[model samples]
Target: MKSLILHTATRLMIGILILFSLFLFFRGHDEPGGGFIGGLVGAGAFTLYAIAFGTDLTRKVLRVDPITLIALGLASLVVSGVIPLITADPFLTGKWLFLEWGNSDIKLSTPLLFDIGVYLCVVGFIVTVIFSLEEEN
Candidate 1:
């Protein structure tokens, strides 16, 4: 019962934090932030949740194994990089995606996708670490 409340609160906080972290991440592309810092901030949410609600619950809520998450993240990252390579561009070059909506334009890019992958990677990595630590302790 107590654990349930704590878990709920932490999960809510994690959702909020992940959104904020994404905002920071996307905003930071031109400013002072990027994938790494934002990823860590996002990962912090899961870590706190794990700390409060035990790893089993955290894993259940997450609905994906950490190893699988990490592998997917890595695969996405590799695929993102490969796009440029296939196009005969240098690795890590940014790819822009333009969306036309009525009279407005929505601009997306590979960098954002890469950042998302990084975010997942960081979360999975941290969760794995936290779970291991808890087991050890």
Candidate 2:
């Protein structure tokens, strides 16, 4: 049994949740929020959608399999750690690259990549569990 209002509300809420999760992910490096929390929020959004509109539809919306996300996340994390080794730095050392646009400088680091990896890994794990459980029921 599905309520039209629930389905409509879920559609709007999902986008907001995903956007907020991204915000949390990006702000994590400087502030309190981080990949783990962001991923949890993201997974929550999807789970909400799954609950509102069957797991099959949720899976279809995702397009890519959760397994793939998990693999990519692991690979990203490993690569972030390995990149420092190539530059004679210790494993997982914070490596920074500065980009100059106009007068402001933008700093990018391996930790950000690691955070992204963590985010993906968590989201994948949660979604997989949710879908599996939902299917069983």
Candidate 3:
């Protein structure tokens, strides 16, 4: 069916979009990009697919429920906040870990985790909104 072909192409494009979003996210720390923008891009992919196909089919392909994704994202953000409290630091305090190997040094931080949480939250939340809008129509 024409719809089926369109759906397939849309899904493929969505996959590409998600990959491109991740590329933007990882490259963000060094340049001028990051999770928030990446998350929006990722969500936009799914939303486009949902529009091309239908919410029911999209949900089946996604496997996980959008509501569950929202909950998980929110929980990740809350857990990240609790980490600082547990360590006796103020909430959301940036914590960093450094690793040195030969001539290379790697830096990791709680802020990164927070950004990841924000990314997930934005993706999940926006996807849910888009899906719900589709359902209403």
TM-score of each prediction: 0.81, 0.94, 0.82
Among residues 3 or more apart in sequence or in different chains, the pairs in candidate 3 whose N, CA or C atoms overlap within 3 Å are: none
In model 3, the Cα lDDT at residue 29 comes to: 74
Model 3 ranges with Cα > 4 A deviation = 1-5, 100-106
lDDT of 1 by residue, 1-137 (tens): 25877767886788898888888787776788777788788778778877887778878877999877788889888878778887899998999889999999777887877877887788778878888888786
Error of 1 at 73 (Å): 1.5
**What TM-score, to 2 decimals, does candidate 1 have?**
0.81
Candidate with maximal TM-score: 2
Q: Pick the candidate with the highest lDDT.
A: 2
Can you write out model 3's per-residue Cα lDDT over 1-137, one digit (the tens) per residue?
Answer: 14877778886798899898898877777787688888899888888778887788778876888778777777777777778887899987877889998999877877677678777878888889988877896
Give the TM-score ranking, best first: 2, 3, 1
Candidate 1: residue 108 lDDT (0-100): 82
lDDT for model 1:
0.80
Tens-place lDDT digits, model 2, residues 43-107 = 99999999999888998988889888899999999999999999898999989998999999787
